[model samples]
Target: MVGVAMGGFCLAPFAGPVLWRLLIEKMSWNWTMWVLLMFARVTVVLIATLAETYKPILLKRRAKKRGLPLPPKLPTGEALKLVVMMTLQRPFAMLLTEPIVRALSVYMALVFAVLFGFFEAIPYVFTSVYGFHPGDTGLTFLGIGVGLLIGAAIFMFLDRTNMSLLCVFQCHRRLNPDCCQQKSERWLSLPIGLFWLAW
Candidate 1:
């Protein structure tokens, strides 16, 4: 419930610029919405057919199906409070304890801002600087897809290497935790990918 709420609301903030970019630089607004609806329909079908893996939830659901009483849903207000508390707590805890995490979060936020700004601003540049048609301008999005694939490849390579490096680094430092190294290495690729998209 919380994931769906936050996912929709958090993503809603960016939807206008996204739709605008599509209309101004890609296909018409009608086609963009049509495609989105199609995607949503496909996603709903996939999720409905997927098997539940959580043991407790699966058991409860099966028991209800077999005529047992179902658990009550949490009250709406209490559910909202729980979502807020849980969502905000762990990140705050991590930020307080981890200097490396704090620094990386700051850097990633800046990179994300630039990337989103570019997504909003590119139509003007592409239409004016390059004099490309909307269809051609939309093709630039392909570059972003390629950059993402490259970043994923880099992350996979780093994941393989991080395990070996942990052993050597552990031998040198008695209590240091390099466990976060893999996460940081994977994240560092975001700024690089953003740079590629901008260029």
Candidate 2:
């Protein structure tokens, strides 16, 4: 699921420029911007309407299980403030306290910085060096997008294989408890990917 989501995220950059170019040619740039803005607004509305709040449902279930009255709802302003504070503070707290989180955060930040640098460089390189038109320059991003999809597929395959191996290891450990120790090998790919990108 995560791999699929990441693929979709990668697809956007590759698809978006081409789509925008078509929209611009058809509708003019001003109208294209307005159309995209309307699309975003509609998406937000649909999500807000369709998305379920699991927290409230879970609270109800807990109260029912205990044979107790439902808890009173928090005041709207207070609830909003609490949510805002937690959302703002928890990430920083984790980044400071958790080594894995901190490391991943720094890695991702560097990766995105490099990705954005490519976004700027690709156009200039393609246009100036290859004498490509604007549309052709945008097409250069397809190579990066294809690389992202390939990486996602590789990681997804590794994750599924790892899960199967983990289940087998667990079964083996049950039979000979002291002989096996569980270890996560999924993260080995991260540095490998980074090295590949550097090369």
The numbered model that scores best in lDDT is: 2
Q: By TM-score, how accurate is candidate 1?
A: 0.52
| TM-score of each candidate structure, all chains considered together | 0.52, 0.59
Error of 1 at 53 (Å): 3.0
lDDT of 2: 0.63
For residues 22-135, could you state the per-residue lDDT of candidate 1 as single tens digits?
A: 565655668767767886899899899988899979989898889998778899999998888789977898898998778768865875697687775776678887798767
- Write out the backbone clash pairs for model 1: none
- In candidate 2, stretches whose alpha carbon ends up further than 4 angstroms from where it belongs are 1-53, 61-68, 76-78, 164-199
TM-score of 2: 0.59
Error of 2 at 29 (Å): 4.8
